[model samples]
Target: MARGKPDLAALETRIGRDFADKALLRWALTHVSAAAQRPDSYERLEFLGDRVLGLAVAHMLFEAFPDDSEGELSRRLAALVRKETCAEVAELWGVGPYIRLGEGEAQTGGRKKRAILGDICEAIIGAAFLDGGAAAAEAIVRAAFGPKMHEAGRSLRDAKTALQEWAQARRLAPPRYRLASRSGPDHAPSFELAVEIEGFEPAVGAGSSKRAAEQAAAAAFMAREGVTE
Candidate 1:
């Protein structure tokens, strides 16, 4: 292993796969900020891993829920593949400690940031795919996300949808979302959004994208209003 690189053997043990190409594994753990000064990073791997994850999850949901409609399966898939869920999986696999972050990002708690963790999770999957093909990647996804897929299939609704339904039940106007602010670099900008429901104080949330920020704000609002599903 490289001096500062994560213990590849340990990581393999956790994810249940050994990489034939150690370089790919290292690339998977490299954050963009770290890549800014290097020749490689996890972004490309993350892109591939995103698709691999979707395919693996979709297949799992299809077999697991033979009776579910397309819409229902999509909802569960979306919930399972969201950044928060990916971050949860990364945390479960102890990926935070393995990620290679830049000095500034490391100081600012990048390891714990949902976006970085989630991206790293996907990048690892991508690396697995490249190193050992689809079987390896599928195995990792199934191990990491299988249980969550089952639970989400049983009960999973986007925060925005849940909040709208809650408001409608009470005959209140649907919640409104507004982009409050945007910052950071073009490649990795942060978004802040405010979500408001009639007769209640608006809540603000931040994320890597406008939709994610909106969802976060909606989730916060729902929590404050004691909405659960």
Candidate 2:
């Protein structure tokens, strides 16, 4: 069963934001499965938070990389605002314990789910925005993502996109992915996929999701081919 009310005060301290209206924070942490109504879930907040994160990250990139071209800035923005980055931020904030998941989702390890973590991260940003405006949202985003933004040698392109571009530059056909195998239970399945490029051996990767497996395969292929960003 879902737990009683989570300690939002501790969550606020961790994320470095205090909500004027605590209900928004509660709503932000609420998963759809635990919500009495779908609208009461974090979905709406997530949508708004996604936009807020993009704008905040874009602005930060503009100021931080004065010498970077528009394309470079765009790539950096993409990296910062990606779901993976958001999920990392959520993990850093220790948000999992506070998420309100239904019994089934809780049992299935929904707290550790990448998608859920990322969505709740954005939802928290949305709540911050609603409670204290853009400044509040940007503050939280900066505190969490700012250090990562300045990290040198970070690959802006996701592995799949990077691999595709690598193949195109070499006049090779686009890489193709095939599902090699799937294992585990329905709630926590693992996927194995192979990515093949012309004139090269296929690289295999495994992950909890097909897209992740595909990206892993692409990264593996690049590694084997001595490709680097």
Candidate 3:
């Protein structure tokens, strides 16, 4: 970590709302990797932020999608909590540019890392909650997620879950994923997969990793099924 402070002023601009307790915002942006190098990193605050984030999202989903079952709400929450989604949210404010990273973490694309960005976003919410309470956090959440929530209402479906639900509801067998193989160097690997749905032709998918490939396969199957609801 650098001896000097990370720019809270810039972060406030990114946040679009200032914190009463500025320290909370500082801690929220602080990453564990950064903290290891910096005097005060955001892990502790991140932990609090993680819980606050989950709760805030859960409450919002519960209220907004009244007819949605717990399972449905959980699915939406899962989609939002993923590193990919969080990183996209951070990208809105160029939040990555403001992170205080350790010497090593900085060198290897830490700024754009999805896991780091997601964690930081959660920590910031935690910080916001601490400084300004649920109301402030809610404002941020609504603004950040407004578009996606509206879109989800028009058409919302997750392939993996949809496939599972399809099988269960029809009293058919569940889908199966076969990791056909993986290749590439240790730093990066490519995965090939074949998803076998009973009574249907297998679907193939490739991804940077096995899990990703499986998800892709699931999505393929979902598309084939014309997934809805």
Listed per candidate, the RMSD to the true structure in angstroms reads 3.0, 3.1, 5.0
lDDT-based ranking: 2, 1, 3
Worst 10 residues of 1 by lDDT: 149-158
Model 2 stretches with alpha carbons more than 4 Å out: 1-6, 176-214, 224-226
Candidate 3: 10-residue stretch with minimal lDDT: 150-159
| Candidate 3 residue-wise lDDT, 1-229, digit = tens | 3456567677687677788887677677766565745447776666777677677778778888999988788888877655456667777867786777666667767787666777678778777888888888877776676556656443344566677887789888888999888885533346889889788888887865566677789878778777654
Q: What is the C-alpha lDDT of each candidate?
A: 0.85, 0.88, 0.72
Task: Give lDDT tens digits, candidate 1, residues 50-114.
Answer: 99999999999999999999988988898888777888888988888788777767777888888
Candidate 1 yields a Cα-based lDDT of: 0.85
lDDT of 1 at 88: 88
Q: For each candidate, what TM-score against the reference?
A: 0.84, 0.82, 0.65
Candidate 2 per-residue lDDT, tens place, 1-229, comes to: 2357567778899999878898999899998878998899999999999999999998888888899999988888888887778899999999998888888778888899987898899999999999999999999988999999877877798888889988899899999999999987654567999999879999999876787789889989988989986
Candidate 2 residue pairs in clash (backbone atoms < 3 Å)? none
